[model samples]
Target: MKDKIILKVETAGTRVDAYLASCLKEYSRGYFQRLIDMGHVLVNSQKTASSCRLKEGDEIEIIIVNKENKIKPENIPLEIVYEDKDIIVVNKRPGLVVHPACGHPEGTLVNALAGHFKGKFVPYLVHRLDKDTSGVMVVAKNEKVKASLVKQFQNRTISKEYIAAVGGNVSENEGRIEAPLGRSHQDRRKIVVGPLAKKMAITEFKVLSRHSGYTVVAAHPITGRTHQIRSHFAFIGHPVLGDETYGGPLKIGEKSFERQFLHAHKLSFTHPSKAKKVEFSAKLPKDMAWLSKKH
Candidate 1:
């Protein structure tokens, strides 16, 4: 099925990337602009630019191509923590793309899952973390479990927790970050907070450990906005380590690690099949594990 979204400009003086960033929570800024450049975005039913300024009363239409990439299944090993008839939980490693997309069509977890299950078992994503981020991910085996899990997420019933290595030594031991994040017009690749952005979003963070120049943090996001944790953390001037898109330089000396120092450490929700509360966790990857041990 063809996916789509319609947005009405609620406020004036907003740029195209900003407006769409507020509307398209699941898509990245670059992805949305690609849509605009490809003639998939209609300003009052006409194509527009990524930087086109918007005023109140402009209607925007966005067509989304969910079919990202055609990844073939490979016999890659998975860190499966839990599995049942309805659900399977995995510790997704960094650099493993969660789904298929045009930008990254091959070597994705979806293809591997498809191959693992083949025809007898089907796995649909209940939720997804970023490609550079690692941690616990839930996959639903059947439609009922998928629908229920999605509802739980939409209703904010599920609690998501993450761990990350930030760039600087954190001053706050514990605090909340409330930011209205929207996409950037200048870069068309980063997320920035703005007025009239969208509904309220909150992230609670605690300093798990502090080191000489870096700190490990635990993040609890009350709202699951796209790149919420990463964007909010970046706004606070402590972007995740190895996060290139969010002002991170190319990582070095961390051959044991790749991408960002982020992991989906925990997910808590109810099991749809057994009707019991369930919480799953993934151990820190080898690199982080080594670092933690050394520290």
Candidate 2:
């Protein structure tokens, strides 16, 4: 997919990178410089440098390519939830990585999808879930669908719901956590709620049931951030059960669980091909279901 942005210069003698950075605050100046260097940014239909000064009435066009490096296909099994010509929804299991990264090179969901649709369209992941978090995920089969789904996510038009077993009994029936999230200053790997947060993260939760020492809550994250739900719950002193990273209880009613008791229970978005809203859901995995019943 190609993204084109046209900007007409209103003031003269401003550097190209400076003007673009002022116009597009979501992107960094370094990103605009790279785009200018790559000939993606053009002035008056001609390629220009980042340091080039802009003049009045000058037309600037920026073209960005949305593409990912080709990945290898692996023969891993997939729990498909829904599929069509343009998109495929999967019930991603815990311990499954969404894509290939530095440490996780194989055995990923993308690899499995690639193998499943060999000789057909390569799957493009629209969003991601943590490796330890099992959930419903959607993949785009084509570039147009990928662009549409990505835009919907950015616009916050998609609704994501999760079911989690939290430690201790929550007193409130429903509540909202509106906090800014950023990397922890002390622990680089963990996120913290602080004034230095660059982005705002909000989570709305309702208690589903209260057990002997745990509470099951349905969470809806308004803004998707890294470990947003886990961190927010931890901040409220109700870490998810079995999530060691956030001080979640290791066992529920004397039964030990291996991973976090969080599941992406539901996902709603506009269908790119059908042009209608559709919602997909994944039932709780065996371990979580067992804990929920036993408690």
Query: Could you tell me the lDDT of residue 226 within candidate 2?
Result: 83
Q: In model 2, which range of ten residues has the least summed lDDT?
A: 63-72
Q: Candidate 2's residue-wise lDDT over 60-138, tens digit each? A: 7676556332356788988899998999999999989876533554678877988898848767667888888998999
What lDDT score belongs to each candidate, Candidate 1 first? 0.76, 0.84
Model 1 has an lDDT value of: 0.76
Candidate 2, residue 60: Cα displacement in angstroms equals: 25
Candidate RMSDs in Å, in order, are 8.6, 9.6
**Top model number, lDDT:** 2
lDDT of 2: 0.84
Residue 82, candidate 2: Cα error in Å is 0.7
Residues 154-185 of candidate 1 have per-residue lDDT tens digits of: 89999999988887778999999998877666
